[model samples]
Target: MNKVTKQNALRAHSWAGVFLSVLLFLVCLSGTIAVFHFEFERWEQPHIQEMESVTPATIEKAMDTFLTQNPQESHHLFVVFPTSDIPRLVVENDHSAYFADQEGNLIEKESVSFTEMLVDLHLYLNLPHSWGMILVSALGAILCTLIITGIVAHKRISRDAFKFRRGGNGQQSQIDLHNRFGLWASPFHMVIAITGVYFGLAMVVMAVVAQVNYGGDRQAVMDQIFTPDPILAPQVGKPEIGKAFAQMQTLAPEKTPLFLTVHEVGAPEQFIEIYAKAPNRMIYAESYRFDTQGNYVGVAGYEFGEWGKQLAWSVYRLHFGDFAGMTSKWLYFVLGIMMTMLCVSGMEIWLSKKGHPVLATRLWYSVVWGSVSALALTAITDMFYSGSLTVVFWCLMVVNTALTVAMKGLSKSVWLMISGISVLGLLVFYLIVHTTASVTIASLQLNIPMAVYVCWSLYRANTLLKRERMAPSAKAQSGSPAQQTPA
Candidate 1:
């Protein structure tokens, strides 16, 4: 490549990295944590009574009881049969679902999980409707730019493809680590960037298309894309849920129905749409429709369609790694951590540049370290506190950011130490509490994984701190006149 081109590419990469690093770090970290969201749900409500077998009869009875309780509501009902992982028959009456005991007695209301909340934050930063998605999309675009420029900037891409120079000067070492990770993980990084952008930008693009082509009716676009034929009004018959469910079972025997929605319930025009799980597919779920009287209608088709719409439909599974089971989740988790590190190291690169001021360093440290500390604190708070997880998360974010900003230039090492200590202590305390108390096996199983992870993080942080402390002393000792002369 030409010198001028190389220089320009390097400059572009450095600027883009500086601009998007913090946001990307936040997104990646949250995405990594969100990989185990369902497991966390199981963790949160271990006391709920569980059953080995869930029959249609049990679910039907539970639904009947739930419907009777909320008789005033005129909407569809849903009953989630218990599974091996989560062994509670959950019944919903429009607003929310509640877990039931073995005898169909109401146990407790299911609350929003912390991991799910984090997933939402990762995707939208918890902003209102479409706006948050747009912002996240913009970040994705920035990431794309960063990736393209980063590739172009590396002139000796081949030679340095697998090179990781250890124990070099700090700048050289950082550069090597950055390049090594970027090279090795290029494909994974591309997948994450594209999928992440697809998720974030989907709504914006849909909204625009809807506005331009469908007179600003987004629902109209969705209907055209997803829904099948509208069921006709039944002349003189009542809807039969059991018959409709049976038809669905016959048609899609391999897949189980996750939920069913009856549009215009109790009306002659009402139709039952059953959303069934696809064991090994990229599409979110295959939907089947039936009339009020449980007559088989049709299946919603996305397989044979315009590439753009088909691509958009597939993005959700690709982005979340939900199409694949635990193996894919683990792959995404590892890639996510690498991506998070890329963001952090990118920022460090910018800070290491000549003529960069102390203020920039302080800001970078506060943002990076503050976010880490905030996440650790959030996990701790979720485990101990019970009131409102959403409230506690926001409060922790506010407090961490404020502290970081306020304490800038006052020894980042000290803050890091305190964060490490707090995380370690909380994890140890949680482990002790869980072990000592008479909790269910399910709860213990969930808590143990998190406890082990926290302990590992604590040990890692402690080791790094020790090495950092010893570095200056070793450097001073090596640089001494007598030692230098002898060497």
Candidate 2:
């Protein structure tokens, strides 16, 4: 409220933004794109047969076929049913996965490596899950810090709400845009931050909870939070999956069965668990349990459980905007882009104030645009090469930064141009590769928008280049360094 307090808040806000700028940008960008991960998965293998529904017998046959082919013991087996969003049946185990046809035949081994890479990057920063998640989640907490401090720092927040001042080293414009974005999106920002923290810190919280309440038994804590596994006897043949499917119709007629999991496969405690989505509800799924003989056991109670349990269950959908179908997904996508731009603009404000140091600016440009380029490169690689996408991604990132800093007089716009060209090239290459096959609706849905983005990026790059070219002339006439600086 006071001048000194506001100054301190401003300092903290700037410091935190600079501290986590790149990581924050990386996470935000990946997460924004990761909103379409399901589409990406569908695009990855558009040739697969997609069906609206598969019969219970078909699922049974597919399971039998999978088991017969792979005799190796598996801890768990999963059969993901078709939905309006992702209309493909996927049968997988802990070790392998395959797409299944209407006739119950296993098709190609499922390959959505690129989409997985993108999602993993967003979720774990491509680091080992144990540690990367903690670091990413810490960024979320810092985001909250930045948000609060930024709000406090803005003394004339109400009057400045709609203000925009261009020119003069572009610092004023950057500040105004950053402040406006932060202010307007504060609610969304807070939700993302809190949910983001919960994902990774959840493990730590559970561990502490287990220590305090369950004698350090994490499973006990889990059992308390989630539905406990149903008890079953040793005698069993193949699980009565068809019968279980039939029983679900009567058990939870209002819910839609999303997937079925066979827990402790081939073991004494093996049972069928069906995860069904409840209509007009946010909980991820309410799981229904059945014995090997397909006798209905009970439900997971997520829909009718304690408030905490329901809240915990709903976090994924709420965080990812997966609840209301494509409309919600698109809304999240737009807001996510705003969030990603917030990260970039936050750093831009700091960089403008710091006079945009050459090395820092170039490195930052490499990170910002290079990430875009590398994602395209990796996706191109995934089309023909089945290698470590994470390695390719990071290696390209390092190379981009090296080249950007190494090349003299290279403007940041060039990197943007490169990013646009690379994405366009990826699109062209994909079309060429799949020229023989008919492009599915899934591919068209993503590719068309991607083309539009490429055009926009290229246009932006040209505009920036023109501005940079005129900067010197503008400086000569105005005799002001601030006037000559490009935004």
The number of the candidate with the highest lDDT is 2
- lDDT tens digits by residue: candidate 2, 66-121: 88887788999999999877899888899999899999999989999999999999
Let me know the TM-score candidate 2 reaches against the reference structure. Answer: 0.96
Clashes of each: 0, 0
Mind giving the per-residue lDDT tens digits that candidate 1 earns over 1-487?
A: 7888889988988887777677777777887777767656766665567777555455556666777676766656666655543556787766777887777667678864666568777888767647787777778777777777888889899888877766755777888888877777877777778887777676777899999999999998877666645757562344555577667667988875666676666666678777776666677667778787778888776544566556767877677676666677778778877778888887787777755466667566666666666666666676667766556667776776566567653344545555566656655655665554415766665556555655665676577667768989999999888778652
- In order of appearance, the predictions have TM-scores of 0.85, 0.96
Runs of candidate 2 exceeding 4 Å displacement:
436-438, 479-487
Query: Alpha carbon lDDT of residue 171, candidate 1?
Result: 76
In the order shown, the candidates' Cα RMSDs to the true structure are 3.6, 3.0
Worst 10 residues of 2 by lDDT: 433-442
Instruction: Tell me the spans in candidate 1 whose CA falls farther than 4 Å from its real position.
Output: 50-53, 71-76, 81-88, 101-104, 210-220, 234-240, 266-268, 303-309, 354-366, 380-391, 405-449, 478-487
Poorest lDDT segment (10 consecutive residues) of candidate 1: 409-418
Q: How does each model score on lDDT?
A: 0.70, 0.89
